[model samples]
Target: MSAPETTTTTALMPMVIGEHRIAVEALSVLEILGPQQWVAIPNTPPMLPGALAWRGRAVGVLDLGPALDLPTLSAPSTRNRNAILQLTDDTVALSVDRVLEVCRAAADAIAPVHAASWVVDGGLPCRGEIELDELVVPILDLDAWAVASRRAR
Candidate 1:
């Protein structure tokens, strides 16, 4: 008999942003914070609207709605949560509607995102798309997003 095959799986944390369901790599997420009172910075883009104090330091809050061409969160709700992401050289909080439990999927389950898919005017960076329970979810590319946001500044 041949040797048993081993399957590799990827861990992802699904989140709700606006009306869309997306996910991020489980390893990149540092923590999730509840509704925070962020200070909007003047002359800043809508995507990077403001910053919030976290652990004695200020962390920029990323509003993916504008970037993803979706409706921005208006009224504050108790369900709102901010996911703190550890990017290359910076730590920022992602404003999300809700944070879901982490899940893992086989490598082959993830598919490439089409060009015509939902993206920003420039481009909404995505690592890939995975279908979880018949729902296709795009995995945001945080590193790429961070770089693009900086360049846009």
Candidate 2:
């Protein structure tokens, strides 16, 4: 007779864009929201898609898929949703199909990625411990992204 061993599972926050999958640490996310009509910001870069009035505060919404120039989602309802995140001192929102789950993977599970166009942290082009499709999605540097948007003006 043998005894069974126990296995532990960690929670990971999941977001979807079409068939692709994106998962991050649940603690990294602040809130998950449903579809909301975002007012598009004109003359802004393709990355800075729009802004929404949240609790009397105007927060910029980033189109993660589009900002990376990835395929667009098919459904209009899916396109209208947003994922709110508190990165650094900024409270920015990301438009995603659905906020799936808050599941977890081991820290060693994530591997590094290489690409100049994709920026992960302030360090050289490398993917983080998060798995986001086959392509590397840059970790949002809210301060830098906001600063770049300002410079674009």
Candidate 3:
């Protein structure tokens, strides 16, 4: 008999934004912080309304609501959290509703995003979708988001 095939699994951190369930690469996440006070900048895009101080540096806050066509987040509360993501050339905080425990799944389990509305500028920042415990979760692609965000500015 041939050798048993070894499946490759990837670490993912599940999070909630508005009513959407999504996940991010666990390796790319630097830290997760509770409700943080941010300084809102005037004349900025709705997706990027503010910045917060992190490790003595001003890190821009990214709100995925507008990007995903979801309603804007309300005032910060106990349930709100910011996930610091390490991008190619910078680090930014992603505002999320709630963060769930990290989980692992086979890499092939992810399927392409079927919702075309999620695409921005010819690309969607979502890597794909994966089903976990009967729930489908979209995987966030930070690198793609960073590139699209830069192009928007």
Candidate 4:
């Protein structure tokens, strides 16, 4: 077979989590939510920061910061957005700093990660750029995270 092409016509919808940036397939995002009141839950992991009341249901929130065991880039007073995943079976919201404009990139542009991160062990893809915003960001694997969360419980 001949060599494959280098570019693809697709783009990605990425969000800034704390200071790190990541992309979830545009189709995977249910909606982008603004800041809201967070209620703490007892005996939960640090990543499970709290829960939010939404549409008559309580949605658990996950903070990518502790989820990856990475310190907040700048004490997150400005990073205050949440990306709700299109969960086919559970309820959880990913607390990010903000959502940026969708950008175009090839599948090969997603660099691999080699270092350590709690999230990586949990379900973060071993691939994706880490040094986004000068900080190591573990691009999350939503499907894997869901699976791990269930296993953790």
lDDT per model, in order? 0.81, 0.57, 0.79, 0.63
For candidate 3, the 10 contiguous residues with the lowest summed lDDT are 115-124
Model 4 TM-score on a 0 to 1 scale = 0.70
lDDT of 2 by residue, 27-119 (tens): 657777787666776676565656776778877776656544476333223364577777566777777777775656565555554432343
Model 3 residue-pair collision total: 0
- TM-scores, each model vs. reference: 0.87, 0.64, 0.85, 0.70
Error at 37, model 4, angstroms = 0.9
Tens-digit per-residue lDDT, 30-119, candidate 4? 777887676777787667756887778888787667644566323223136777776567767777777877656566655676543554
Once fitted onto the true fold, the runs of candidate 4 whose alpha carbons sit more than 4 angstroms away are 1-10, 68-79, 115-123, 130-138
Candidate rank order under TM-score? 1, 3, 4, 2
Which candidate number would show the highest lDDT if scored against the true structure? 1
Ranking by lDDT: 1, 3, 4, 2
Model 1, stretches more than 4 Å misplaced? 73-79, 120-122
Better of 2 and 4 by lDDT: 4
The sequence of per-residue lDDT tens digits that candidate 1 reaches over residues 1-153 is 999999999999999877778899999999999998777777887777778888999988888887667765442322279999999988988988899999998888888886326753336688888887678888888899889878987
Residue-level lDDT of model 3, residues 46-91, one tens digit each, is 8777788889999888877776677765434223899999989779
Cα RMSD of all models vs. native, in order, equals: 2.6, 6.3, 2.8, 4.9
Model 2 shows how many backbone clashes?
A: 7
